[model samples]
Target chain A: MSTTNNHEPILSFKDVTFAYEPHVPATLKDVSFELPKDSFTVIVGPSGSGKSTILRLVTGLDKAQKGSVQNTARTRMIFQGGALLPWETTLNNVKVGFTGRKMSEAQKTHDAMAALTELGIDTLGDSYPRHLSGGQRQRVGIARALVSSPELLLLDEPFSALDIETSKRLSDEVLRIHSEQHITMLMVSHSVEDAVMLADRILVFKDGHIAEEIPVSLPRPRTITDPEVQAIIKHVQGTIPSSG
Target chain B: MKVTHTELQAKPRMTTHYWSHRGRRAHRTNLLHRIGSGLVLPIALVLVTGFLATGVALVPSRISAEAGTLLAALGASFLRLFIAYVFSLVIGVALGLLAERGRRLESALLPIFDVLESMPVLAFFPVVIILFLKANLLEGAAVFIIFFSMVWNIAFSVVGGVRQTPEDVKAVGVVFGMTWKERLFKILLPSVFPAILTGSILAVADGWNIVIVAEALRAYAPQSDKAHDLFGIGSILVHASSTGDSTTLLAAMGILVVAIALVNIALWQPLLAYAERFKFE
Candidate 1:
């Protein structure tokens, strides 16, 4: 809805397929997508439906054996569990992605603090990961990913473990980050409301293939009550089974 | 009467705080109770042992039989062990990191450590002597034996610690952009602190057992024709077996047990306490 000029794809996954084990048939098969620049895309699917596989392949965490993926090399992933290193303070954890790199310690600390401060967690710089609340930890997760100034940010159900309110708050934070940083975001979220509220496009995966790509033409700072967003949500709900 | 949404949320939040406070209080009480209970056992032992030693002749028969000499031997052995422990810890940590990072190398080298652990230290006494003789590393020979006895446990424990690292934690490291060294130092080492301490405690025990044998075995001087008497539990056992000294042998056995107990309390207990401060999340 933003622009019909779809000539350039920031990331292209051409017929990618992957499996967890050799004996098993592919968890994802012939999955293909072209993500445009600075787009907030959400992939929703049932469990074992290759939503995570897509994220992993895009982030280069796991390679696809069957097909090729072309994307920016500097892709940072935010794991579902907010896997902040337990030993690190919030700032140090953010800086861990830059340790021993060309950046000076002072610069690393400053950059890490800037990221945390942007997420409204600057006071938690010295606090260890164990000390933070669930929402706080997710904020740290976002900070860690953003601190690297990555070209592409991959989010793997980063709010699934949180309460509904916390999840919404985190989603708002993520939206703020996307708008501010302008990083291409590909998130895997199961919540229909989450997909509605944040994503520019919602991708529905079924049986290892992207079954549907629904575009939201809703206005910025989108809320759940927007009629267009609700209709799209209803459409996505109808397309996917209720159990998912 | 409808409760506000904030009021509804406040109830669970307040309850959580209340429960966590209660849990903290219970934990503190439990710790105090355990400490109190542990003191009783040590006090009762002191009473019983004092009663047993009453009116027994405290004459110094051999150097080890004398309390002063036994104390000195314990101190020297402890010093040797401390040196060995420091070296093993450094080497084990380095090797463990390498082994964890290098899977192929780990598979190759880990079996050798397993075999070394399986081989009893006593079985290698002759080998240690022969090797020390050929190498001519005089001052550090006893320490070498101590180090050898302790190294494998630390290495294996560290290896296990690395392997047992939760996938969630590793993912966190990757997401955060931790370098190999930062991951090893901050993520890996702190995560494995308990295992390292557990292995260290076992290693200290093993090294203590081997020290007496090492000193006694090395006390033999062939050319001088007068063996410098090695004074330890092993020496006591040797003398008792040779001359049919039952009471003294029992006394020596008691001494060895006490020595082991003291070392466990003084050395390993503190380390264990320190390690336990950092619980697994």
Candidate 2:
């Protein structure tokens, strides 16, 4: 595991509130949290608990109705279902991240290829999203996010569509990337196990509020069967209200 | 496992192999074969038209003269249809973009368009003729009628395309920091290209269906005569049929059929194939 200094906050939500419809109650009400730089933080909660909304807020894809979202990092979002452009090849999809940048076409291609190669998908650069497996597509999505070298990477249920083994493999790959790059990583997931296994810090959300913030100080390469990891997972799961 | 240079080299060769196999299969039904097969019917129709025009095989001299006149009329009709179709395409796509921009615009415009589209185009002919005649644009009146007949299908198709745009794709654009203009041109337009192509095909067919009626309106116009009337296949066919000139009528119909067939073969087929690249699936 790579060491990270938690002295600096890369992003923070200060009493943020938002609503999709004027007649409805706010989806996120007085949500406040700080994400430390170079930390892997996961926001876990039940469905419609506004964990995903927080990710969108951090990425600036949604605006807060009240209060403020403060961030000091260049950010990119990894959406659910990969969200790779179907018409673009893997390389081209990643290359899109370089849009508006001052780079030559060849330099953009080279950087895109490098990003894909890092994700173990360099050979699939020419393959369209429709032609790739779900896992492969997600890797391309990661490459697209990573090619820009964002200081903050936000992922919203990115591995929920994959099987357990594939999800574990990708989770491990994400850990490796996070440790190697020391980027601030914020992920939102409904899976307690994923939060326990992958996150350095877990923020539990309930009813649009941060119910608890749990820090996993365990050693690297923690397994699901580990007592401490399982204990944290069980605790997080118990905190979330069961659906009737 | 770490990837090596050798593995990278080998991967592209595999891609090449896969594509080469696809290319070989495509080579069997290459461009030459496609063009040759497409031309067969049009070529046969041309030969028959030529035979009739030359008064060969018992065709009367008067019938031959009518056929020559009908061919010129067909050319005139096609020119008008082409102009009308181009104008409709631009207006339809522009209106579609406007309608797609927001719910308020769509609600305000789509119902009006729906009503206009369903009304009999001939009902608007008098209005069109008067408007254009006052402007001294007789050809413009005919073109406008055909344009009205064709524009609605394309506009509706564009609306459908915009509505069906994938949510994920839009999110991708947003996350990537693409400007509104870039998103419109690079993503939105390409995503709707297949829809546009489908709409254009329907519009062209609609144009063909109405072009005859639009041109035939010339027969009812004041001071209309063979020498001064609108010169078009529809006008010629109407005149020949009314005068009991069966040979001229047959030739006019034959020429129109051949022209439509040739356009479908030479233009629409290739365009449809190209547009398949833009389809999401």
Model 1 regions more than 4 Å off: A1-8, A20-24, A100-107, A225-227, A238-244, B1-68, B94-116, B136-145, B175-178, B218-279
Error of 1 at B269 (Å): 5.3
Top-DockQ structure, candidate number:
2
Instruction: List each candidate's DockQ score.
Output: 0.30, 0.40
Supply every candidate's count of residue pairs whose N, Cα or C atoms clash at under 3 angstroms: 3, 0
TM-score of each: 0.76, 0.83
Strongest candidate by TM-score: 2
Q: What residue runs in model 2 are displaced by over 4 Å at the alpha carbon? A: A1-8, B1-72, B219-229
- Per-residue accuracy of model 2 over A1-244 as CA lDDT, tens digit each: 2233478688989999999767898889998888888889999988888998887777677899999999778788887778877677778889988867889999999999988888887888877776677788888889999888888899989899998878988999989989999889999997899889999899989888999989999988788999999898888888888745
- The CA lDDT of each predicted structure is 0.70, 0.78
Looking at model 2, the pairs that clash are none
Per prediction, the TM-score for chain B is 0.68, 0.76
Please report how far candidate 2 places residue A191 from its true position, in Å: 2.5
Taking candidate 1, what TM-score does its chain B reach relative to the real chain B?
A: 0.68
TM-score of chain A of each: 0.93, 0.95
